[model samples]
Target chain A: MSNPNMKLLYVVLALAILISILAPFLASSDPDGLESAAEKIIGEERFTELEEAEAAIDSPMPDYSIEGKGKLGEIIAICLGTIGILAISFGLGKIIKA
Target chain B: MHIPDSFMPLSQALIYWAIALPFIFMSLRWARRDMDEMKIPILAALSAGIFAIQALNIPIGMGTSGHMVGAALVAIIFGSPFAGVLVLTLVLLVQGIIFADGGITVMGANILNMGVISGSIGYYGFVALRKRNIDIKASAFIGAWLGLFISSIAAAIEMSLAGTFPLVPGIVAMGTFHFVIGIIGEGLITAIAIGAIAKARPDLVDDKAVEASKEVTL
Candidate 1:
């Protein structure tokens, strides 16, 4: 890639990282559209059941926020999440293009 | 929207998986046959961007918020709906395994809703508009919005079919909210990304050339 193109790529990646780190902090604690709609339509008790049902698997990082680590943990989780995405994308890219 | 296990019932989940797997396999084959090696890093970067953006939820109102899925953006950039499918699959997989945002049992449904349906339909929407000589930016905005809107509809349908809720109300609720988010959140994001790439590295985007070739044929 040319120097300018490389720089643009870096900018895009940097912007992505910034958003991943900062946006979570600003996000509302409310349920998203699907959840909110389900809650309104089916009522809270059933929605709670749906939420509880989500505990079918034990995840390393539930809800993308680690337990007991607070903000720092979230930052670390975001970094790890970014790395995980990059790894999968690059790995799949290579396999596809190979 | 991530569908948790047992959230959609086993039958609906399995059916969605059955629908998504063939498209995924075809996408892999398509990538192997058609992709240029030079585009790999770009795709990786874009996929990472999509994941990051998805994590960022912009508040819409009524104590709710929405995030940009970016499937349509990938479709438009890569000139292949399947590319969107693959990228979203990777993103969803990471979220499912690490974040536990989505359930393993309903991974198929998630992939189907976010990847297969949104990506393919969104790409085609862009293509169709481009063929009609619509401006690139406008085409992207409309395409992405439509894709997201349709995906929301599909999700609502799935929820209803699973007997989680009534179909009409779910459709109305999901559709109403996502319509706003789709146009405002997804459209702006897609347009800005495409605009930036077009300005900085026009050569990176294949959609323009694809449209040009189609124009000649038409």
Candidate 2:
């Protein structure tokens, strides 16, 4: 963080990680706009069915948490996700710029 | 505005993928030609921030919650919609594949709605507003709001096409819900983030845009 620009990057990354850590406890559990709209238009049963339908690939951390691991699990999952995207984006940028 | 796989039929999903591919290509070209070494860190930071913020949904009443999409923030900072597309595409990919927060089958539609539509509208809208002598923060707020609102409508239309919801009702519901979310979540956060970044690192942002905005204030 010697460079001012690097300092800015570190600050942003730190803030992002902090937010992710807090998200599990602070985030609302209610359905989002799309889900709410869909559930309203089509019955809740159908909406649930649609959501539960099988996907091509099963996510390692579904719903931002490890199964049966509760809020602690969510914090770990989301923090990892936040760091993962940063690393991936940085790596991709380096590759592209290279 | 993440559309799950079940919301869109395979045919419709493929159509969205067809539409999104060209934009993705153009964004890659932008990265190759226009993106310099200076922008790499900013891009990574913003992508991480967007991903993290999206995970924290705030309750917006009516038994629903919403989060900041961050398309406008990225576009405005980079002074290009392609930056929004590029970062958002990456974030959405991770969210879709790793968290299952969004669906893989309909990742194309998600990209189209959140990445392409939101990014294009957010950047262009901000520029258009600034041209009218509006303050930068205000312009960013309105731009972000408009981007999210319009993208929500686009998602509703796609859902209707998939026979998941009726067109008019879906539009009304999605539009109304996101309008509130945009105001409270997307618009406010975007304005705040941009203001903070511009204050701290004027060198990183678009010089002309920041200069013009400063001139407006002074």
Best by TM-score: 2
C-alpha RMSD over true interface residues, each candidate: 1.9, 0.9
Candidate 1 per-residue lDDT over residues B48-93, each given as its tens digit: 7888888887888877788888888988888888888888888998
Q: Model 1, which residues run further than 4 Å from truth?
A: A1-8, B208-218
- lDDT, candidate 2, B7-54, per-residue tens: 888888998899988999988888898777777888888999999999
Please give me the DockQ of candidate 1 compared with the native complex: 0.66
Alpha carbon lDDT at B91, candidate 1: 90
Tell me the tens digit of each residue's lDDT in model 1 across A16-74.
78977886687567777788888899999999987987465688988878899997787
- For each of the candidates, give the backbone clash count: 0, 0
- Candidates in order, TM-scores: namely 0.94, 0.95
- Please provide TM-scores computed only on chain A for all of the candidate models, following their numbering: 0.84, 0.94
* Span of ten consecutive residues with least summed lDDT in model 1 chain B: B204-213
Best-fitting candidate, measured by lDDT?
2
